[model samples]
Target: MSAARVPGYAELLTAADAPVLQVRGDWTLAHYRPLAEQVEGLRTRLGAGIRIDTEGLGALDTAGARLLHSLLGGERLAALAADAGALSGERRALLRAVAAAMETAVAEPAPPAGSAIGDVLEHVGIAMLTFRQHVVALAGFIGITLESGLRMLLQPRRWRPTALAANLERTALDAVPIVALLTFLVGAVVAFLGATVLANFGASIFTVDLVAYSFLREFGVLLTAIIVAGRTASAFTAQIGSMRANEEIDAIRVLGLDPIDLLVLPRVLALLLALPMLTFVAMVSGIVGGMLVCAVKLDISPVMFLSVVQNNVGLSHFLVGIAKAPIFAFLIAVIGCLEGFRVSGSAQSVGEHTTSAVVQSIFIVIVVDAVAALFCMEMEW
Candidate 1:
């Protein structure tokens, strides 16, 4: 029969006809299902001479192929079946050619262990390489930063007051309450701990000295910087990293804007200005917390606690802490902006860089603090 004029299936079959059945049509699972059922009726009558003539079939999906095999009693039945096509093109190729062969359909293959391990190693290698690339980029960025800063300093006219003030306000004024509250609690806890330990030795009076000296010398500034680093550094990385991902950084460059000047500088300046002020607030709140602990635990009057702090802690200690504020600010801003700029294509990259920014900022803060401590110790300041 001509391919286009394959019989409407029912006409080709008769109870009296030999068991050999010539099937035709689209040969889909839907069409073939009814015909397979009809075969059962013929089974009791004549017998099975089932010859599935697929020559006239236009197409066969995977489901149709499986149904065909099932009708044939599987592979042994498949040996009995014959193709209907006669020297047809690939498009009209036999069922085996059209559909993937079913090999006792079973479990899906497990993913290769070596391939998975290779994939993990590849990702790890990419991360390590990206880190190295970023370190080099950061070194270059630092050079650019120093050059820009120096130029801005030399030509004070280049410095925009609005930009500086805006940055300062964001970094300083907005961060005050959180910094204050955190420092206050830290100071209170320290004072309580010191008072408890010292009280055991009948040296509770020294709690004031401990709180005052620690806060002014290190804890107040370090804690405040760390908080800001975690909060604002991550923010900077996320913001700039997202912009980088979206190609806004490229747009800025196209517009002849120095992204560092337009973006990083303001943030850096704001952080530098804000950090010292935040540190001052932290110190004040911490002293107040110490006073609370002293009043409750040490039976020290507020006036006496204040008097002890004033006597034991000097202006130099406060100045030293304040000095570290700018350094911490620079580290936070630089590390945060560097991380943001490091972001490549994916959301995952942004997350990694943001995490790196926080970690690196905190690490640099501690390193700077250690150095400052050594300097202070050497000078006996």
Candidate 2:
């Protein structure tokens, strides 16, 4: 058998004005370690004016070619290509390919830096654009829902009473105990705080007015809306998103059915009917709790508490609160259904859209409440 050839080595020759690096022997991976170390040592000492002579190279491979190309750098390799005698046609082609690849691997330019105020302004602009897009989408969804609702009203046979009833039971009846319990506790806490503050001024009796005004005008509908937004809205998104992910919505469309009417109308109608009733229940529960607290802590009788609430709290306040409930319910249902339609065909998409639905429902409910509050204030309601 023939003896195995020795690994490659690089020799720096400094005899001429420009230094010359000569490569020789087998340059394959099996003999590449010593060649790599020798090339690396010569890399720093070599200058742009250095000449690489690869004519003596034997058994060259991709690894060796890469090592040599990197040692010479792209500019130097390009310059060396003109002198074709120094490398074989195959080695020359390999070197050219490596240089071209290295050139393409150049990093992208760094982003420009800006002042702190400029960065803040840029972020604000982006946020405003995103908000505008969200608002536009919501408005489009509302228009579609309204169109469906009008069509349903014109054709009463299209109504899904069973689905509406089921959703109503899920969103309202099952939710009653928690809504009442939460509002009741909040009412008691408000009464306690009001009594503590008013006692310093010797007007603890005003605590009944405080609790009644707050619950009847704000807390009742607002708390119920928030609860429904978190619970029913998320449920709507998850259910519809799962259906969308499974292509059931597409199947409905294929069967000549409108997904908006079949899927969204039931939820919207249910919430419209349910929210007002739940808000009324919340108002009553909260008032009862406040009455209990006043009776126990402020030495006020239940009859006197009811008399004060009846005399001081206007019917308009209850009307204002109840009026906001349907609007909030509409928005929550629309947002949930809209997000569900946005879902992609994946389990992850369902989860992400469900979360988005709850967040958007809550946010829009708050915005609507704020706007209504401002309108009521201006009108002196």
The numbered model that scores best in TM-score is 2
Model 1 lDDT per residue over 1-381, tens place: 564444224224444545445545544555666756755454344334544444455455555555555544554234433333432344334445423356545779997667878999999999999879867876888888878787777877667778778767767888888999999999999999998899889999999999988999899899999999999999999999999999999999999978887788878888888898899999999999999988987789999988887887779888888889988998799889988988996899999999999998898799889988998899988
Output the TM-score of candidate 1: 0.68
Off by over 4 Å in 2: 1-18, 24-41, 47-63, 74-88, 100-107
**Where's the lowest-lDDT run of ten residues in candidate 2?**
1-10
Q: All candidates: CA RMSD in angstroms?
A: 7.0, 3.1
- lDDT of the candidates, in the order given: 0.78, 0.88
In model 2, what are the clashing residue pairs, if there are any?
Answer: none
lDDT of 1 at 81: 35
**What global local distance difference test value does model 1 have?**
0.78
* 1-381: candidate 2 lDDT, tens digit per residue: 211265677888996579888877777788778878887898888876776776677777778777777777777877765567776678778778877887788798999988999999999999999889889999999999999899889998888999999999999999999999999999999999999999999999999999999988889999999999999999999899999988999999999999999999999999999999999999999999999999999999999999998898899999999999999989999999998999998999989988888888888888888999999999999
Clashing pairs in 1: 19-49, 20-49, 167-270
